[model samples]
Target: MTQTILYARVSTSEQDLSHQRTQAEKAGFVIDKVVADHGVSGVSTRLAERTEGKRLFDMLRRGDTLVVRWVDRLGRNYDDVTDTIRTFINRGVIIRTVINDMTFDGATKDPVQKAVRDALIAFMAATAQAQAEAVKEAQRAGIEANKGDVTKYRGKKPSYSRDQFQTVIDLLSNGAGASAIAKETGLTRQTILRIRDDQPAAETALVKWGM
Candidate 1:
């Protein structure tokens, strides 16, 4: 039987995965399993290198269907996203996105169809990568624009709420390591370190960005 699998990636646990699962269900997919990588940045981590992501690759078989929230869930880089898609397709696994119900398959025998499929894959991958870069650029611009108003500006709103940040601080106060805090709170290890090192600055960014 051709099993259905859902792959989800989130940089923080604060970000909900249930939404993605709900989306897949709404799209009429019967997911046999769900594999997710939490607190891992999509822009920096390749899908194959992620703990749960690697397992997904191994669990998938020919004729199985893999669903994701979007192309970016597979990867945030152009080359990585496209290459990962190609790998799954080559394995006879059908890739589908919940965001658009888009499907990519390599089972087509026609040369023209294959070319069109390949072209679409490249275009989507590039677009996903561009979007990720655009977000980073926007954040940089926001910070640069506010450098002069440090006193008035609190910083971008953090991804974690005030209470959540307090929890991080409390953990750090106990001499907990970054990795430990990350595992406990679903925040990235880098985030934990940032909170531990310069909490005021991190809090300011959180307030400014309203993250």
Candidate 2:
């Protein structure tokens, strides 16, 4: 029997894997196994270099099917995503995305079909990369904007709730490094650092905004 495996990756712990799994299930995937990497930035780490991602590469058989919520979950760069999909396809694995039910199979010998398939893969990978960068840039911008205006900012609605923010503060109080706290809470390193360095200000803003 051909196995159906779901590979989910999130840069922060705040991101939920259940949502991705739900997306896959809604798209009619019967996942036999799930492999995930948490609190690992996709932009900085290649899927092949991740702990669970490495295991995914080793465990997937030739006839196995791989499912992902989107191409971005597989990688953050266009070349990396394209190359990773190609490598899996070359091994007779079917790669499918839940978002569009996009399928990539490298089983065709026809030159025209191969070209079309390759082009689509490249486009999708590039799109995914662009979206990831956009989100990061937006986050950076939001942080910068909030830095100058305490009363007007209120911390851009926060990525985590008050309780979650409190957890970050507690970790910092315990002398945890920003990176360590980020890994522990599934938050971005920037977020961890900001809360760590300015917990008092953040707490004030949270209370003021009732966040």
Candidate 3:
């Protein structure tokens, strides 16, 4: 029995996965598993730390079918997205999209059709990145609207625990770089970098909380 798997992600937990769910269901996918990365930015093309992204590897098999709202769901950028799709296709997995009903399959007799499919995948991956940028722009607008309002906290909790973050620092201090740390921990290099470069205040919180 071939199972169809649905993968989805939203940059913020506040953003609903319902839309992707609805689309996949409407497109006739049974959705054996829903792997999602909430509050994950699509601008990141690496399949590094996306909770669902990693799950996709374990859940997928040669015969299983993969469905997504779009290619962007797999990646935040074009090259990564294309590489991923091609790898899946090479592995004998079928990739399908709800929008445009785009399909990329490796089982084709004609060389021309294969070329066309490859080109389409490349184009769609770029489109996915463009749409992700749009999503981020919209989120920025919403954040700006509530700027300086301090009355409300409108964001999802961090997936990494404070202890885990400090552990990241400790590991770094112990001579671990981003790549090494990511391998040591389950987190992505980008996530570690984000903690290091963007969130210095988080370090104080870690110390104050005894993490």
The candidate that wins on TM-score is: 1
What does candidate 1's lDDT look like per residue over 1-211, in tens digits? 7899999876765555665676578668888989988778888999988889989778999999999877888975999999899999999999998765789987899999999999988998998887677656655676687787865445444667644665576567556788988998888888888877766566446545443
Clashing residue pairs, backbone N/CA/C < 3 A, model 3: 11-39, 12-39
Residue 103's lDDT in candidate 2 = 87
**Candidate 3 C-alpha error for residue 47, in Å:** 2.4
Compose the digit string of candidate 2's lDDT tens values, residues 80-176. 9988998899999999877657789878999999999999999888887875676456556656887878655554566765556745754564567
Off by over 4 Å in 1: 148-211
Candidate order by decreasing lDDT? 1, 2, 3
lDDT for 49 in candidate 3 is: 62
Displacement of the residue 178 alpha carbon in candidate 1, Å: 41
- The sequence of per-residue lDDT tens digits that candidate 3 reaches over residues 1-211 is 7788888776556656766776567657778877777777667636656766887777788878888876777776888899889888888899987765678878896999988988888888887677556545655664577687533324444556644664575566455699888887688888888876645444333322323
Q: Could you say which candidate leads in lDDT?
A: 1
Say which prediction, candidate 1 or candidate 2, comes out ahead on TM-score: 1
lDDT of 1: 0.78
lDDT of each: 0.78, 0.76, 0.70
Clashing pairs for predicted structure model 2, backbone only: 13-186
- Ten contiguous residues minimizing lDDT sum, candidate 3: 202-211
